[model samples]
Target: MTRKHIDCRSFPSEINCSIAISADTDRELLEAAVQHAVAVHGHHDTPELRNQLRGAIMDGPPTEEQPAR
Candidate 1:
């Protein structure tokens, strides 16, 4: 799997930021990651947010649930 560039200059208060997702990564995915960081990590402002998203790159695509085959 490869990585993509994520422009996360939206919030502006993150640290050691990196989306760790892909550029093509959707809003829901991005939101989930950011929310996770904000909720879990100490991302409260622009810098922190930025850091938390600086090298943001996608590791793998998200997975959806499925019934037993």
Candidate 2:
């Protein structure tokens, strides 16, 4: 099965976080993303937040980076 990943850089945030999380299953990815969001992003954990994180998950590897601005 293809792995899933979520890149903080792909999402627009006030902090412009660059963390990336990946896993073999959706559940694993969600768990890691939630932890990072709470610990690093100062986001409160909740059912709605989990759903949003799950929605943000992307299939396969992350996209290639463009040159820095």
Candidate 3:
């Protein structure tokens, strides 16, 4: 299966985050994304946030060109 990842540049953020979180498994990716969201994005870890992060996961790595925000 394709690797999963969450790229900060994939979404529009006030901070214009450029980080990308990737893992071989969904559990690992979600946890890492949660930590980054909490630590760097100053977001509280909530079920809703988790759902949002889960939804943001993509089937591949970050692209050289970010999608238009």
TM-score of each: 0.36, 0.85, 0.87
- Which sections of candidate 2 miss by over 4 Å? 66-69
Ranking by TM-score: 3, 2, 1
For candidate 1, the lDDT comes to 0.46
Best of the two (1, 3) by TM-score:
3
- TM accuracy, model 1: 0.36
Cα error, candidate 1, residue 38 (Å): 1.0
Off by over 4 Å in 1: 1-25, 45-55, 62-69
The RMSD (Cα, Å) of candidate 3 is 1.4
> lDDT of each structure?
0.46, 0.84, 0.87
RMSD of 2: 3.3
Worst 10 residues of 1 by lDDT: 60-69
Ranking by lDDT: 3, 2, 1
> Which one wins on lDDT?
3
Backbone clashes under 3 angstroms, per model: 28, 0, 0
Off-target runs (Cα >4 Å) in candidate 3 are none
Candidate 3 lDDT tens digits, 2-64: 888988887777999999888988899999999998999889999999999898888886677
- Give residue 55's lDDT in candidate 3 (0 to 100): 88
